[model samples]
Target: MKRKINCETARNFSIVKALEKLGHFPKKSNEKEAWFLSPFRSETQASFKVSKTKNRWYDHGEGIGGNVIDLVCKVLTCSIKEALSFLNGDTLFFSFQQQQNLLKKETGIDIIKVQEIEHPALIQYLNSRGISVSIANTYCKEVWYLYKASEFFTIGLKNDKGGWELRNKIFKNSSSPKSYTYIQNNNKQLIILEGMFDLLSFAIMEDVLLNTSDILVLNSISFIKDIEKFIHKYIIVHLYLDNDSAGKKATQYLMNKYEHVIDKSSSYRNYKDLNDVLSYENRKEI
Candidate 1:
């Protein structure tokens, strides 16, 4: 058991805002009720309900309901004691609200500068993942942006849809109007990857093969439905995705929808993903 010093405060804190941090923004909401997709599981329909009047939540899918503390425990997979410690520390709560407010107040990602990928720190970071400078330079640009009044730089991969997928050692974020990166040439064959790093890993492994077809890097799985129409245009579609539950679900989703869709995760079956596979291979070679 743990002390209840912050229990009451944590209980009454905005569950809505907290859920937003968990990427569970409500699909529909009124003064009393907010409904969202069950963040705990993969589902198309929204089943998670948040009651502002009661300041509690019920994931109808999970058949369970509780206050903010309970929700945090479930999200973090931690104990009530651990949850309380986390809440008292005020990391998630304060940080989330601050970030949310910043988004509302600011215009969007403010590009301070765009440069070549020559920063030694960034190069070292890429080297660890088996991505060479030349390969990264071809597809990625070094971008410095301001978010929430803090200046940061990352390797930015511009998507076809006029937004950037930003990444670095400390942070991972995509610019507004998120969409997949499509390296298109031939529409006959399509290679679908979950993230930019995976796409980069694939490019490094098989650069010649990459040019032979179009590549679609989802950037985030939220764009899965958005890319349905585009995927149909390709005669052959190869999926290289993470082996986790969401990835497995996405793989199955594509398989059921399209006849040509193929899961190519066998190469990295033992590892987490393509990047993992590439890094491990590089280590073995050394």
Candidate 2:
């Protein structure tokens, strides 16, 4: 059995080493202290610091500081018990890696062309995700884009801002000016979804040859606040979110803020989301 280490012992553990283990190397360092980029938020300058001698850490941006345990809690966003278990090797913690932000990438995607969905590879990709070619053709387009001077293509779903959400077998990205996608059908009842694929999956599952209600694809949960203006008038709002903590929290937030908000995630509670269930069911049939 793994042994438990108390807070005092965990505190004395080298903060510099712990930060390094979490894939956060110091930008500047001396014998007494080291400065690092804040893991909590992205910035060009290093504002997070670890004291080598005192064995403590601080984030200038957040104005928070504490021992290694506190640092772990902040980094993992977990409780003390969870952090202790994580540090004890009882739970595996994946080292955090900085992801390239599509909105802020230096070599932003340049759309070379946009046309009908005809790529065999893209059709296979959609089929792999249990999305039929007819559904994809109806809702998406084939987009050829240039990134880092290399040509690439993917399935594109257009948003309200004219930007495209790009997805393929390997990479998922979006053009700048990202925003949600809404399809209004003059219906009082609205269906809300996290992504376009979820709506397509729901259509396939329900055999929705004709859309009976208005559709709103948030595209990203960050755009959830923007929904208030569009959703306030709807008599009933159906939420089809992922079966995850963030999804559940967003579901609750909408339910608390609006009337006739129904969570339909229970239909796919055993899976991650609507598309996940569709993919799994497709796999089961084969």
lDDT of 1 by residue, 187-275 (tens): 59989998878988999887787889888888876668888888878888999988776678889998998899999988789987899
For residue 12, what is the lDDT in candidate 1?
A: 75
lDDT per model vs. reference: 0.75, 0.75
Point out where model 2 deviates above 4 Å: 1-104
In model 2, what lDDT does residue 161 have? 92
Cα misplacement distance, residue 169 of candidate 2 (Å) = 0.8
Per-candidate total of colliding backbone pairs = 0, 0
lDDT, model 2, position 196: 72
Pairs that collide in candidate 1 are: none
Deviation in Å, model 2, residue 259 alpha carbon: 1.9
lDDT value, candidate 1, whole model: 0.75
Tell me the TM-score of each prediction against the true structure: 0.65, 0.65
**Can you write out model 2's per-residue Cα lDDT over 159-220, one digit (the tens) per residue?**
99998876765334467667888988898888998887887897898755228888888877
